[model samples]
Target: MTDVRSELVADPVGEPREVAPTTRDVTGLDELVVRCTACPRLVAWREEVARVKRAAFRAETYWGRPVPGFGPPDAALAVVGLAPAAHGANRTGRMFTGDRSGDVLYRAMYDVGLASQPAVTGPGDGMRLHGARITAPVRCAPPANKPTPAERDTCRPWMARELALLRPTLRVVLALGGFGWQAVLPVLDEEVWQVPRPRPKFGHRAHAVLPATDGGPDLHLLGSYHVSQQNTFTGKLTPAMLREVLHQAKDLAGLS
Candidate 1:
């Protein structure tokens, strides 16, 4: 377990594409992702948020580095999110942990039998995903939670490599928002599966079947409104709505 970060300090901007392709497994990929500094804006923003400290989290230390995906390597279902929340995953160092959005998302996942608990307080709270994995297109939190298209493209290699490594058992991808949906398509089309000629549109409950290019089972892509506070508080994405989508994803992934 060498400190890969040391190897990356020399050329932070080109590390993702350079390091991602060489990772042979999810564990290795996660290690590399946590060390990425490919986007200068993202790196600075994530670290600044960690330093400022939210009022309630002031006493606690923040995990300012890029957050990596969380779950078993052999997961059958993959959950793709936009990116780590400045005060959420960026604080806890785990996707969807220590945040309201995670509370909503995990509740639905628990109800659908994909999660071991209904809430995740932080990284070591014993929460776990069964036959599922959670990740994001961008590894670091961005200013205003909106990553520029260039930043998104720069971060694409990480997600692409992650999904490529998961191709053996991954059956269904549950995109948590339009951004996640758009981010995942090119990865599937160019790296793992054969996307349809006319790419599928993004909408809650939107579904698409991507034929596997390596002779594996077809991959199912399911879209859902992000479980962000804006959506949940406004009733745009209800708990029941998310549960329905999770249930559908589970069945499609052969987890149910």
Candidate 2:
């Protein structure tokens, strides 16, 4: 069998922090993201997980590289999550794919007409997001689903550039989990909107509207508990609750 890691493209010349700012569009930024090897720890962990096959996925080849955002370039709404999952996105090469958390997230998105399918089994599963994109603060799946502060900082530039490129039509951002909410504030403040003093706190259904630095329409920021198993299995984040937030975000984004 061929080594999956060998099939991955060599890392680009510069680091993510340096290259991300120079990227002009989402496509270029995504290409850089997939080629990133900036975080040594994350690189080792993701590749390690991909090698040590999960029992159910033992026969499958894993996509150990960083996963890029999923959806259209001109999406009006964006969903931000903490990071890719080790057994999930790390294996499938798509955010929120092949996991229980994704099961809940895509279902809610589909219910609100943001997704073409209700669930994703893997990449090329015919799933599509309509007028909405899903991304994360960290592209690679971190160990124990927790990325170190350093890793998060190193990965921030990619998302910063993504939001900057999306600023033309992107209106509302739905952040899943407190980590994602906190991580996105600086991206908004530095790239497009001027975040308020004593930055907005995060909670399920919490909302904040940030005025644009360039005098454009305001961007709405919405928060929700992550669709992790701990939250969903415990009913902390229910289907009804998630759909409600999606509906409000869609309205704010003017995506009917």
Candidate 3:
């Protein structure tokens, strides 16, 4: 893949802008999530899917509920993903769980001491991310795994609000794919997350160092290929490779 460059310190919107984190909108995150009914269609779809899938899958009864955010209440690294999977995180109400994708990601995280366990079926599964949190570009499951730009926009405020809440402690943002990366870039200070690449380009192992408006280079951005099923099956990503990236990340931020 080619290296995609962004003109640092510009608004994430394709056009130049003064503000960032346009995706994040609300505050009081945990409470806000419980009351989130912003996407009525998604709510109905999940409930309906649960009803039908229940009878069809007696042994694996549906969780039949809204998805909840995961990880500790406070974290330094935020892992942003594309969206929930119909049978995976969306069903389990925890990001990346109940799916092969989580299999790879959690295992890798465990190896690096980021997680205490290698499994995350949902809340209270005894899984913990000692230093991180996981979020999605779009909170709800989209039809056919493709979020229309409008749907993506609707979810942006939720994400933006979350970022604002975390501004005090967050040191790094890890984007799992190209879409996740784009979704986050918009919310950052223009001087930090700039774009010079053409639209719709996916990058791997990319890192950006941002200078803070508060007079420090505190925030760091890192990109990685998602631990998607396709990537695992094709050996596109491996444990050693991911470990190297984590080491580099820790080094970049002087974590270790």
Top model number, lDDT: 2
Segments of candidate 3 deviating more than 4 angstroms = 1-27, 54-57, 60-66, 190-202
What would the TM-score be for candidate 3 when compared with the true structure? 0.79
Please provide, for model 2 over 36-153, each residue's C-alpha lDDT reduced to its tens digit, 9 standing for 90 to 100.
Answer: 8778778888888998969999999999999999999999999999999999999999999988999999999999999998878987789989999999999999989999998899
lDDT of 1: 0.89
lDDT of 3 by residue, 75-149 (tens): 677788887777776667788887889878888888777789976666678898876788886766665667777
Which scores greater on lDDT, model 2 or model 3? 2
TM-score of 2: 0.96
Cα lDDT of all candidates, in order? 0.89, 0.90, 0.65
For model 1, name the residue pairs that clash. Answer: none
lDDT of 1 by residue, 166-201 (tens): 988999999999999999999889975888878999
List residue ranges in candidate 1 displaced over 4 A: 1-14
What ranking emerges by TM-score with the best candidate at the front?
2, 1, 3
The per-residue C-alpha lDDT of model 2 at residue 176 equals 97
lDDT of 2: 0.90
